[model samples]
Target: MATFALIHGAGDAGWYWHLVEAELRGRGHDTVAPDLPCDDDAAGLVEYADAVVRAVGDRTGNLVVVGQSLGGFTAPLVCERVPATLLVLVAPMIPAPGEAVTDYFANTGYDEEPGGDTIAVFYQDVPPALAAAAVEHGRHQSEARLGEPSPLTTWPGVPTRVVLGRDDRLFPPQYLRRVTHDRLGITPDEIDSGHTPALSRPRELAALLDSYVEAVARV
Candidate 1:
């Protein structure tokens, strides 16, 4: 069985992959999702990458590293350190040179005030149930970490998969389309879910992970 390292977005713990993790394990794959030090600005990109590397333990056999949201920006760095078989980005925070996480909030018209709840970054047409869940799981992020550029330019030259949420509001569809297609030079698989697919669409998301592992074995 191949190993998969799952990373969650801002404010969310490793539990983000609860559903997907269970499904993948049932399918005979090993999965590890570590809780990132979300509240710590003391640890920057390298620290985040280190956390992921530790989660994988020894880099034996085929390993796939999946990063969601903010974890996306840091996943490539982990691949740089670990011998991952493939890198999968799910509705992640795409990084650029000299760009900060604050840039997204500034340009994307997001405000951090709503009766103590921060603005919802992704999912525009959210159902009431999903909206409430999203808010609870969402957490405020440190500008220092995101503002710092990703240490590595790109992930290893493995089979990389960019899975886009068809209805993600946090990162604009146009930008995700461009980065996944043009910037990264990878045609991503499409998922008809909001930003938090792991929470809402676990089986569908798990299937995507299974597909990636299977495809890599063939390669």
Candidate 2:
């Protein structure tokens, strides 16, 4: 049985993955969604990765590390340390080799106000009224982390899965598809939900992942 480590996106916390984690557990899979120290600050990647590694503890079982949005930057690092069975990217913000998260957002087309609760609203998928709720709960990330580029010389050869939010207002589905298919050479599983599938569409997201896990076992 493989353990699942879920890393959340920016302007968000481990709370976001609660539903999906429960669902995975229900299916008899081990899981953990750690709270990264990324709040109002931009959070450096090294610190974020270290936090993930720490939370993973000494569990030497087969692992499935799922990185959501900003979490994509840290997931690969976990893959580097542990014996990862899979690296799953949920509409990930994949930083190129030696490229930082800042690079991805700079050209990401969304407007970045860069201050207080205002920044949270810009990245949230919930309605305007609920977006504010995320601000308080969201952890303050370190700006230094955003500047630290992902340290992957090459893609992890281990099995990888990517889940795309079809109606993702943040990372357009088509764009994500292009990258996963044409660029990465992997046909990612698709979800017709928003950027926050674990929150917005937990059932669908979990069902899809359940199927993939089964599929992987047979391979």
> What is the lDDT, from 0 to 100, of the residue 177 in candidate 1?
76
Q: What is the C-alpha RMSD of each candidate to the true structure, in Å?
A: 3.8, 3.7
CA lDDT, every model vs. true structure: 0.74, 0.74
lDDT (Cα, tens digit) per residue for candidate 2, span 102-161 = 776554444523343443423355555445555666765556556656776677777888
Report how far off residue 62 is in candidate 1 (Å). 1.3
Output the worst ten-in-a-row residue range by lDDT, candidate 1: 110-119
Question: For model 2, what is the alpha-carbon lDDT of residue 196?
Answer: 77
Clashing pairs in 1: 100-147, 101-146, 121-170, 122-170, 123-169
| Candidate 1 per-residue lDDT over residues 99-206, each given as its tens digit | 566675454444433232233545344556756766776555665666665566644666678888877765556667766665577677888886778866788999
Model 1 alpha-carbon miss at residue 50, Å: 1.1
